[model samples]
Target: MFRALGAVLAAGLILAAAQVPATADTRAPARFSEFSVTPTSLDVDHPTATYTGRLVFTGADGTDQGVPGARVCLDKDGRCVATTETDADGRFSSPVTLSSTGAQPQLRDGEAEAFFNGDAERQSTFVGSGIALHVTQVQARITMGFDHTPSVVGDPVEVSGLLERQTPDGGWIGVVGQTVRVFVDGTRIAEGTTAADGTYRISTRVPVSDEGFWGVETPLPGRGYPYTVAFANTWQRAAHRTLVTGFNAAPEPVRKGAKLTATGRVMRVTADGSTEPATDYPVLQFSADGKKWTDLYEDHPNSQGYFSLSTPAERDGYWRVRTEDWPDLPSTSSVDYVDVGYRTAISGFNASPEPIAKGRRLTVAGTLKRDTTAWKAFSGQSVKIYFAAKGATSWTYEGTAKTSSTGHFSHTFTAAKDGTWRAIYAGSTTYVTVTGPGDYVDVR
Candidate 1:
């Protein structure tokens, strides 16, 4: 009885094994029929593109195995331009190389069909099986990136996209928060993950040296190669690189009474490197008092990180230049200053407590004037007052008063019921901050 039971069990095992499906293999049994390609569609960059396509074979009782070592090809009429072989995993992949300059390949444009042939020993003509795959050109667009900028190798970076991708199966896929690999001039910079809303914020930081500018490249995974986004500028980097040369950090005390210049590279900084200089926002501004600014020259960055600005030297005062920061792109030197001449200039001066009252007002005063032969004239200029209580973001405009023809103005603010008081003395639109006594003023 035990022997009979063992025999029955062994027979049952054999039956199950026989019923098992035959994966794509060179020695698959006959009667193997039916082949389906997953994704059923493909998005290739161009004619000379290489992409992996999955082909699945289904046989009777799943016993039908895949035909490994089978050749697949694409042809126009009779000439075969590309050929691919099935892998052990039943995947057939080939570089769909074509001439972009000449005749372009299109869907249903030419007789492009996949074929599979069984081994010579097999009585059937067809190999495991062949399925038709539709090909389409991938839709790509230029997308700008924003900085939640991450520089550290493991820091999270915030990246968002403005372009959308269409899947092969007629489905619209948004690429806003798509995670992509960060690369620098063909080298892998780092990997980043996209946010839930199609924006990506990579926290991973990259190792940065004193490179002038690093390139930023992002590759859509399993889709295509990397595309550049922006460039970053650095002073320590030896060689010139791709980057948007906006405003770099300007140094103090440029030169007095001569032409002052400040220039540097600007680019996007990511775990990756800098991007090519495509867009430039060049700026060259000057300030005589270092409080009021004037733009002498301005231009955009070109493909190269070359920027030049020329301004007159200060005679007896200080002057400086400034620029705005770019998104994703780090500025080289945004500002710089210089002082020309044997200057005995008043750098800064401040006074406080407006409205001249203990409980009802707070007052403050200040002046910003160049040390010149006409310094006495500034003393006669009108001055405004601004006030605010503690924890206030903006100062309240109180009133304007003229100096006693001596560039000096004062006012006492009537406080309602003061706890803490602060004042600002406006100097030609510029204001100085000053705080009053914190002692509580008696309202009674």
Candidate 2:
């Protein structure tokens, strides 16, 4: 245990000891020794982004030793963000890497202090600023594109890129007449000097057998990044892959909830009008009016590059096969039209007691059935009756008939002049409308 003041009182101070210098004290005194940072500069952009410094104190014998444990902060304010302990060399290192992204390029100031293990009193050593650091957001970037991706490997491809600077107003301006290098697999293959508009075009060959990434890099000097990336190889332009998609579906006029078999074939286009089977494939996709395309099912293609998917004819829509784009292959799509139709049937339309006298009652009967599923009877449908004089271009509305439970409809008409009679139904969203040629009725 450290000697306490109790020991000083045990040996009572006498008037004779007062004759000694006023500064004389039995206990040792602690004072600031040394405080400094190495390198005197920091780069906030580096990954190892941290600063190191040390703090020490002088003993009563004038020998400097590193403080074992001390409180440290990054500002003049006495708040300790961290605590540091000294090593055998009396040196303490606290990392100063925690900085905000917006911190500007400026000197950082700090202070350090120590506390007695069991005492409230404290000693402080201030750290004046000397280190300079830069904190900023990188503003230079590049944009580039290819004329056609998935081209034949080992063949020539047109590659282009542009060097640009992000302005203060959030706009971009081209960095004109700059030397840019093109790299493939980290090897410099070609170089292009920027034009007046900061754009550069280079014709290069495929670097790899299957595929290889190509990028644009700039060698800007000084405070900025020494090797900065302007563009990354996103599209494999030197590709030698092609995907041919084709699709077909039946029955031509399928009904809702009916089994629909969609057929498709995937081929690799080696040349114009030439193709080979594509073994690696996925299922088909379908879409309806006002709806997005969705996968038909998780069905892979057969070894012959042929795929068939059976899905319920749920709605009116179109089906297509989608070929995904990958490392060396370009994508493609082929569509097949599908119409879900309603099988509507009109029957039993006849007038009883033909040749009836005018103003006499005549009964007309019929039935309206729609093939929802194998010709189900549609009941409660409103049917309009129309009549036209014999040899007339158009018919005139006569009356209305409401269908019964069996889809049977009947209307009693008082025979008027000679004319024709028929029933017409307006279509609904799911069913097709039905119209019929009138049953000729003669008036005596």
Best-fitting candidate, measured by lDDT? 2
For residues 1-444, what per-residue lDDT tens digits would candidate 1 score against the true structure? 999999999999999999999875555334324333344344443334443443345556864455566565544334466677777755665656543111122322233345445455332233333344444545544243536433443234444344345555665544443345544334554545444433444333334444423343234322222211222222222222224334432323423344556666545433345454434465565555666666667766556646655665554343333335433332334344443532222212333333234454445444324344344324554455554555556666667656554455565656564333323322221221222222223333
Indicate which candidate wins on TM-score: 2
Please list the residue runs of candidate 2 whose C-alpha ends up more than 4 Å from where it truly belongs after superposition: 1-254, 264-267, 271-282, 286-293, 298-307, 316-318, 325-344, 347-365, 370-376, 383-402, 410-426, 432-444
lDDT of 2 by residue, 1-444 (tens): 336676666555654477576763433333434454443343324312233455555656876665555444443124443455556554555554433111111222323233222112334545544333332334668877776663565556677878776655778777665667777767777777777777889777656533356677665532423223356566454443556455677875676788888777666644333566766455567888525888767466787778887888877788766666453364545667776767566788877669889999998889988886477667998999988887789989988898898989989989987878888887566776678656888998
TM-score of 1: 0.26
How close to the true structure is residue 127 of candidate 1, measured as C-alpha lDDT?
30
Output the TM-score of candidate 2: 0.35
Number of clashes recorded per candidate: 96, 1
Residue 233 of candidate 2: its Cα lDDT?
65
TM-score of each: 0.26, 0.35
